[model samples]
Target chain A: MKRVKKWAAAITVFITGFIFLIPFYIMFYLSLSSPGDSIAEEWFPRALMVQNFREAWEKASMGRAMVNSLVITVGAVLLLVFCAACGGYGAARVKNKINRMIFYIMVLSMMVPGIINTVPLYIMMRRINGINTYWGMIMLLACQSLPFSVFLYESFIRTMNSSLEEAAIMDGCTRFEAFWRIVFPLLKPITATVVIMQGVGIWNNYAQSVFFLQNQNYHTIPLAISTFFRPMELIIICLPPGRQLVLRLLQWFF
Target chain B: MMAPAAVLFLVFFVLPLCQGVGISMTDWNGFSEEKNFVGFANFIRFFSDKRALHAIQVTVVFGLVSPFLLNVSGLFLALLVDSKRKSRVLLRMIIYLPSIISPLIMGYLWTLILSPRTGVLDQILQRFNPSLSFDWMGVPDKALWLIIMVNVWQFTGGPMMVYLAGLQSIPKDLYESAKIDGAGRMQAFKNITWPLLYPSAKINIFNNIIGSMAVFDIIMAITMGGPGYATESLSIYIYRQSFNGFAGYATAIALIMFLIIAVPIGITMRWMKNKEIEM
Candidate 1:
C-alpha cells in the first residue's frame, strides 16, 4: 500500500510538472515554425524553419527597444545599488533617532500599492518633460523599488562583520576609502541578489513602460511585445533570454 | 550618504502621493492649461458611478480568489516537491518556469491558448467536441477567472519556495515523535506540519493578497479590461480613467484602492505579529 501510494504521488508530480511546461513548449514550437505555414494546434511542426526570428526582430524594431531596455535596466540597477547600499550602510551603522525614524518609515511605507502613485507621477513626468526620457523612467523606477532594496541592503549589511571597516579606519584609511576598498567587496552576494531582482524587475516591467514611454521609440521589450502582436517577436524575446534571466534570479532565493 | 535615496524617495514616491491627494480633490482633465478644484466631487461621483462600483466589485473578487487559490496551490506543490527524491529539484524548477515570464507575456500566451477559434486548447477540443467553443476573453466572468488563473499560475512559484523552506526548517524530531506515537500520516501532518508552517503561510498570504490586488499588466495584455469592462481591475480602471482625461477621478479611485489594500494588510500584519508573540 505504501509503495502504491508513493508511485501515485510521483506520477501526480510528473503530470503537474508536464502541464506547467506545455505552454513554454508550445511557445517554442510556434516560434520555430514559419508564420502562416501551418496550424498552431499541432504538437510539432513537420519542418523546423528558423527564419522567423530575424524577421520578427526587424519588423518590431526590437533592436532599438532592446537597446532602450538595456540602458534603462543598467542605469536603474546601478543607481539603485549604489544609493541603496549607501543608505543601508548608514542605517545599519548610525544610531540616531532621525535615522531610526527614516528606516522605520521606509520599511512601513514599502507596503503602499504602486498603482496609487501612477496618476500624479504621470503628471510630474509631463510637467518636468520626463516623458519618453530614459533617465526619467529609470529614476522613477529606481525610486519605486528603493524601499525594499534599502531594507534588504540594511539587513544584509548589519549581519556582516563591521570590525574590518573599523580597523581600516583606524589604520588611517578615509571613510570613503575604507568602504570602497574593504567593505563593499564583502557585499558581493547581496549585490548579486539586488542585481538579479532589480534586473528582472526592470526588464519585465510593462505598466510603467506603457504609461511613460508613449513614443514607440522608447518602448521596453515587454511594452513593445504587448503593444505589437507578433508571435515570433514574443518568443524571441520572452523565450530564451527571459527564461535564462529568471532562472538565474530564482537561483539566488533558492 | 542617505541624501540620494531620501531625495529620490521624496521626489518620486512621497511627493507624488501627497500630490495625488491634492489632485483627487479637483476635476482637472489629465492635461490642460486651466484647472479648478472641486472638493469631494470626484469622490462623490465614485460612490454613484456604476462602472467604478463594478470595477471595485470585480477587483475585490479577483483579489480574494487569486490569492487564496495561489497560496493553496503553492503549499500543495511545495509539499509534493519536498519528498526525498532525486528529481525533486528539477521538478521544482519546471513548476516555477512559468513564473519567470512577464505576466504580460503570459497573458498574451494564455489568450492564444484560450482563443475560441484558432487557440491551441480549442483546436484540440474541436476533434472531440466539434460544437464546443470557449470564448473566455469575451465573457465577463470567464475573463475575470482567466485573469485570476493567470495570476495564480505566475505567482505560485515564489510562495512554493517559501513554503518549501518553511517545511525544511521544521525539525524532523517532531515528526519522528509523532510517528512513534502511532499517528497516521494525516494525524502527524495535522499535529506537526500545519502549526509549524504558520510563519511561512503568513508571509505568503500577505504578499499574495497585496500583489494580486494590484494586478494590471496581465489584465491589460490579455483583454485590455475589455468586452465592456468585464475584467476591469481597479488598477485598470485607474489606467483607463487617467488616460481618458479624468486624472482626478482616477486618483480618487486609486486612493480608494490604496486604503482598501493598505488597511487590511496593516491590520492582518499587526494581528499576525501578535499571534507570533503569543506563540
Candidate 2:
C-alpha cells in the first residue's frame, strides 16, 4: 500500500508538471517557428527560427523601447524606496494619531481602481507638462507604488529594535540624520521586496501609461508590444537573458 | 523625512482623486472648454441604464467566482509541490512562469490560440475531430467563464507562493504526531493543515477579490466586451464611457465601482482579522 501510494505521488507530480508546462511550451514553440511551421500539425519548434527575434527587435524599435522602460522602472523604484523608507520610519516611530490615519488611508487606497484616477490624472498631467515626459511617468508610478511600499516598510521596521537610531540621536545626530546614517542601511530585505514587487508592476504598467504616454518616442515595452499582436515579442521580453526562471523563483522559495 | 514622498503622493494620488470626485459631478464633455455642474444626475443615470446594471452584475459575478477558484487551485497546487524532492522546484517554476507575463499579453496569447476559425486551438481541434466545432469564446456565458479561467491562470502564482509559505511555516512535527496517532490523511489535513492555513487563505481571498473585480486589460484584449456588451465589466465600461464623451458619467461609474470594491473588502478584512485572532 505504501509503495502504491509513493508511485501515485510521483505520477501526480510528473503529470501535473507536464500539464502546467504546456502553455509555456506553446510560447517557445510558436515564437521560434517559421511562418510555414503550422502550430496545429507540429507541437514543437520545427523551424528553430532566430530571424523573428531580429525582426521583432528592429520592427518594433525594441531597443529604444527597452531603454524607455528601464529608465521609468529604475527611476520609480529609486524614488519609491527613498520616500517609502522614510515614510515607513516616520509611521513606525512617530506613533501619532495623524500618522496612523495617513498610514491607514494609504493602505485603503490600494483597493481603489486605477480607472477612478484616470481622467482627472490625465488632465492634471497635461496641465503640468507631465503628459509625455519620463519624469512625469516616474512620479506617477512611484506614487502608485508608495502606499504598499510604505506599508511593507512600516511593518518590517516594527519588528526591529530602535535603540541603534536612538543612540545616534543621543550622539548629536538629528532625527533625519540618525535615520539616514544608522537605520537606512539595515533595510535591505524589505527594500528588496519593495523593488521586486513594485518594479514588476511599473515595468508592466499599461492602463495609465496608455493615456499619459501616447507619444511613440516615450513608449515603454508593454505600450510598444501592444501595437503589434505578436506573442514572439512578449515571450522574448518575459524571459530575462542568461537566467532560468527556475533559478529566479527558487530564491523566493528557499 | 518622507517629505518628497508625501509631496508626490499628494500631487499625484490625492489631488487626482479629489479632481475625479469633482469631475463626476459635472456634465463636462471630455474636450469641451465649457463645463456645467449636474449633481447626482449621472449617478441617477447609471441606475436607469440597463448596460450599467448588467456590467455591475458581470463585475460582481466575476469578482466573487474567480477568487474562489484561484485560492482553491492555488492551495491545492501549493500542497502538491510542497515536497522534499528536487523536481518539486521545477514543477513550482512551470506553474509560475505564465504569471511573469503581463495579463494584457496573456489575453493576446489566449486570443491567438483560441480565435474563432484561424486560431491554433481551432485548427488542432479540427484535425483531431473533423465534425467537432463550436464558438465558446463567442458565446456570452462561456466567455465570462473563459475570462475567469484566464484570470486564475495568470494570477495563481501569487496565492500559491503565499500558501506555500504558510505550509512551510507549519512544522512537520504535527503531521508526524498525527500519523503516530493513526489519524487518516483526510482527518489530519482537516484538523491541522486547514485550520493552520487560514491566514494565507485570508490574504489570498482578499487580494483576489479586489484584483478580479477591477480586472480590465485581459477582458479588453480578449472580448473587448463584445457580443452585445455581454462581458463588459465595470472597469471596461468606465474606460469606454470616458473616451466616448461621457467623462463625468464614467467617473461616477468608477466611484460606484470603488464603493463596490471598498465596502466588501473592508468588511471581509475586518471579519477575517477577527477570525484570525480567534484562531
Candidate 3:
C-alpha cells in the first residue's frame, strides 16, 4: 500500500509538471521556427533559427520599447518602495488613530479595481500634461502597487523589535538617520519580496501601458508586443530583464 | 514621512475615485467639452443593457469559479512540493514558471493553441479523429471556461508559494507531539494543519477572488470578449465602452464593478478577522 501511494504521488506530480510546461514549450518552439513555416502546420520546426527573434525585435522597435519598459519599471519600483516603506513604517510604529486610519484606508484601496480609476486618471493625466511621460506612468503604477507593499512592509516591520532604532537615536543619530541606517537595512527580506512582486507587476503591465503610452516611441514592451500578435513577438515579450530577476528570487526561496 | 504616499493616494487613487463617481453621472464623451449631467441614467441602463448585464453574469461566474479552482490547485501543489526532497525544488520552479511571465503572453499563447483550424490542439486532434477540430473560444460557455482554466493555470503558482510559505512557518513539533499521541495522518491534518493554515488560506483566497474578478489581460488577449460578448468581464466591457467614446458610461460601469467587488471583499475580510480572533 505504501509503495503504491509513493508511486501515485510521483506520477501525479510528473504529469502535472508536464502539463504546466506545455505552453512554455510551445512558445519556445514557435519562437525558434522560421516565419514562413507555419507553427500549427507542424509540431516540430523544419529549421531552428533564432533570426526570427531579431526580426520580431526590429519590427516591433523592441529596443526602444525595452528601454522604455526598464525605465518605467525601475522608476515605479523605486518610488513605490520608498513611499511604501515610509508609510508602512509610520503605520507600524505610530499608535495614533490617524495612522491606523491611513493604514486601513490603504488596505481598503487594494479592494478598489483598477478599471474604476482608468477614465478619471486619463482625464487627470491629460489635464496635468502627464500623458506619454515616464513620471506619469510611474506615479500611477506606484500608487496601484503601493497598498500591497505597504501592507507587506507594515507587517514585516511590525514583527521587528523597536530597540535597535531607539539605541541608534540615543547615540546622537537623528530619527531619520536612525531609520535610514537601522530600520531600512533590516527590511531587506520584505524589500526583496516587494521588489520581485512590483518588478513583475510593472514590467508585464499591459492595459496601463497601452492606455497611458499613446506614443509609439514611448511604448513599453507589453504595448509593443500587444500591437503585433505574432508568436515571435510573444516570445520576445515573455523574456524581459526582470525574468532573470524573478528567477533569481525563486532560487533564493529554495 | 507618510506625506508622499498620502499625496499619491489622494491624487491617483482617492481623487480619481471621486471623479469617477461624478463622471458616471454625466453624458460626457471623451473628447467633448460639454459634460451634461444625466443622473441615474447610466446606472439604470447598466442594469437594463444586455451586454452590460451579460458582462456582469460572466464576471460573477468567473469570480465564483476561478478563485476556487486556483486556490485548490495551489494548495495541492504546495503540499506536493513542500516535501524536503531534492526533486521538489525542480517541481516548484516548473509549476511557477508560467506565473512569472506575463498573463498577456500566456493568453496569446493559448489563443494560438486553442484556435479552431490553426491551433496546435486542433492539429493534434485532426491526426487521430479527422472530424474533431474544436473552436475553444468560439462558443460563449466554452470561451468562459477556457479563459477561467487558463487563468487558473497562470495564477496557481502565486497562491502555491503563499501556501508553501505558510506551511513552512508551521511548527513541526506539533505534528511530532500528535504522532506521539498515536494520532493518524488524517486526524493530525484535520486537527492542526487545516486550522493553522487559515491565515494563509484567507490571504490566498482573497487575492484569488480579486484577481479572478478583475481579469482583463487573459480574456482581452484570448477572446477579446468575443463570440458576441460571451466572455466579457466588467473590465472588458468598460474597456470597449471607453475606447468606443463612451467614457462616461464606462466609468459608470466601472463604479458598479467597484461596488460589486469592494462590499463583498470588505465584509468577508471582516468576517474572516472575527473567525481568526475566535480561533
**Cα distance off (Å), candidate 3, residue B129:** 1.9
TM-score on 0 to 1 scale for chain A of candidate 2: 0.87
Span of ten consecutive residues with least summed lDDT in model 2 chain B: B270-279
State the lDDT at A38 in candidate 1: 32
Candidate order by DockQ, decreasing, is 1, 3, 2
Reference contacts reproduced by model 1: 0.66
The per-model DockQ list reads 0.47, 0.41, 0.45
Better of 1 and 2 by DockQ: 1
Off by over 4 Å in 1: A34-41, A230-254, B277-279
Clashing pairs in 2: none
lDDT of 1 by residue, B101-199 (tens): 678778777766676665667767776688987788778768888888878887798899999999999889888888888999899888778878889
Which runs in model 2 stand beyond 4 Å of their true positions?
Answer: A230-254, B180-182, B277-279
Per-residue lDDT value at B140 in model 1: 76
C-alpha RMSD for every candidate: 4.3, 4.6, 4.4
Better of 1 and 2 by lDDT: 2
Candidate 2, B111-140: lDDT as tens digits: 656766655678788889977665668898
Q: Fnat of the models, one by one? A: 0.66, 0.57, 0.64
